[model samples]
Target: MRRNTTFLSAAALAVTLALPVQAQDAPDAATVLARVGEAEITLGHALALREQLPEQFLSVPDTTLFPAIVEQLIEQELLHQHKADDLTRRQRSMLDNEVRNFTANAALSEVAIAAASDEAIAAAYEAFAAEFGQGEPETEYNAAHILVQSEAEIEEVAAELDGGRPFDEVARERSIDGSAQSGGDLGWFGEGVMIPAFEAAVMELEPGEVSPPIETQFGWHIVRLIDRRDAQVPPLEEVREDLSGEIQREAARAFVEELRAAAEVENLATDMDPSILGQRELLDD
Candidate 1:
């Protein structure tokens, strides 16, 4: 059996094939490419379809892609013209949803563009650095502690350490906290991380000196300061992308809030079953 194939007009295919080599200097998008019935397919339509092609298709040569894409657009135009007056309820509903989604995206793009301008991004970066950057090198502490359920347990652990038993050995045998297995090593941390009382005790201890039992909500603690160092802030370039994203999100949120405040909205479904959201069949008709 000989299978039949629908192909584009020979002249149209020749013109499309030549487009790849001259793509950089192609005519204006308004130039007409083909016509299906009364509907016209323009260069813009072909370019838009090309943009939406899957990533796998991107590596295809432009010469090969140009005619194929144009043919696809012509086929789609023909189908659209044939079905224009016979759309099903589902198709109409989907078109309405797409219109809403694209409109919302267009508005968000405007907000993002204004928010990400060079001047706006620079100002945001300045503000973020002033608020969060360390103006001077800040101190970090390396410390360890033995946590116990009762004051008596902490006292016993402290006494063993004073009597020349190793701090890690004492912690492994007596501490109840999660770090006990790792010799109660808290790793390096800055101030404001531990509870107020615990931090205060840690700050007061000299390296190699153990504290008397300190009380916190978690339990009693014997802390040993191991070392300390000053940490510097990262360069602005290292964090610019994060700052720009934060500014864009804040701007979009503010824009949406302004629109919401000026609009009249009502919750007509206040009494409706919330579980109705799980019923995809509701969109059927």
Candidate 2:
């Protein structure tokens, strides 16, 4: 969803989306919640109508909510009583401004949403798939190895492994990687998840085979391939909303850039020091 920057400075209020109880068995004042001259409207009736407001409006604080709503209700009632046959010039100007702002925002939003249509999303998916080749892909392993700064230590661990000692036990007692506590299990991942050299060593082995001192940036690795699988595409339903929002944002950004290109905006102080502009701050109130 778009950021609600316009409403950030608006008054705070608690919103309630519930119908009020009738005063049939209670006080008379409750039955006459709204009084405009001789006319009267019940609190219960207004509360019942409150459900029609937007969810955000229903969540405002009562302190700001009640007065604003009361004023609006009174105005609406008065306007109904004395309906204008035609709008005044000022009214037309105000309405024109409102319409212009609304149309601009609406058009931008509609363009963004339309860019996320199923066909567009499907094309994006196809592009990603193409990069991975047209066959079922292999799952790559992701693991970190810690190498001690000694060769003898590597040999001692290799011997323990040859003697059927648990791999995790050897790693905890010897391997310097932070993952030693977790048996050096680097978590599940797809192919190409590791550096090319490191990945090559792991891919060569069977699930239980430990490598013979393969070296990398950190040091030598006693590699183990715990698991492997054919990679698969996730179901579209699981990512539909994510894909839609991403597409919408891209569309909006492109529209903004296009507008910028067409406009002839001038920077009067373009040659002035950049620091001058950076120090200016607007007062909130």
Candidate 3:
């Protein structure tokens, strides 16, 4: 169903205001800020308009936003009053759908908020730390390679390296892979990052030592171990916000699964062709 975009836009203004705003003692909702004919725009109306503004516009100072939003609301109210009776059947249906969608969203948001409590977050963080933040440091490798399409080409490259020709210079001249431009520098990576055959070769080498020709899915490679180090886990405070978000998502999924399992649901359209979903004409009915 088609909705009146203008009416939805107005309703969105109210929805945005339902979320928390910047810290300030908000004025009473009844405080009238403007009058367009018999219509009254109050402090609450202006606040809702401010909430609906784009992210870039939010950086605009409240002193600037207050008067501007009031003016915009005044214009919107004037237009809405003039056009209210002209709404189509499709517009009404769409409005009903929008209301249902927003109401469900609001309820789900409350469930998510409640699930992501302080205790839940702490437990999630502890589980994460146990799995990945063990006291043993995570190892990372810094390495380079020369890749070629065949054993013959890899052997030729190895000869060049063995003869003391610079790896970067030879890579720039002959290596077929994209990293050839960067002297085959793969930079730093952790375990499980590289192909098993290539990683095995790398693990066996010391700094400045090169691997004999190794074959993998990609091709043949002569690898050099540049350096290696252990990576430390970041402090809890540094990742708390991200961790909290993950906890909330997991909690919401579990809640939904529980509801689904406990509830009776049926697919009434079992015999209908799925392709019918693409028929926009169905919306007309």
TM-score of each: 0.59, 0.44, 0.59
| Model 1: pairs clashing at backbone N, Cα or C within 3 Å | none
Off by over 4 Å in 1: 1-26, 133-229
Model 2 misplaced stretches (Cα beyond 4 Å): 1-139, 142-149, 234-249, 266-285
Rank candidates, lDDT, best first. 1, 3, 2
Q: Which tens-of-lDDT digit does each residue in 228-274 have in candidate 3?
A: 88865556787788887887788778877888899998879999999
Q: What digit string (tens of lDDT, one per residue) describes model 1 on residues 173-258?
A: 88898999999899888888989998999889888888889999999999999988875444667777887788888988999999
Candidate 1 global lDDT: 0.79
Q: Which ten residues in a row have the lowest lDDT in candidate 3?
A: 1-10
- What TM value does model 2 have? 0.44
What tens digits encode model 2's per-residue C-alpha lDDT throughout 1-285? 222222322322233332343446664535655666776666554554454456787776665665545544555566655754466665555567777777788888989878988899888667755765676666756453545557777777778889998887777777788888887778766766776777888788777677787667777677777766666665677567777788898999999889889999787997888787464342111
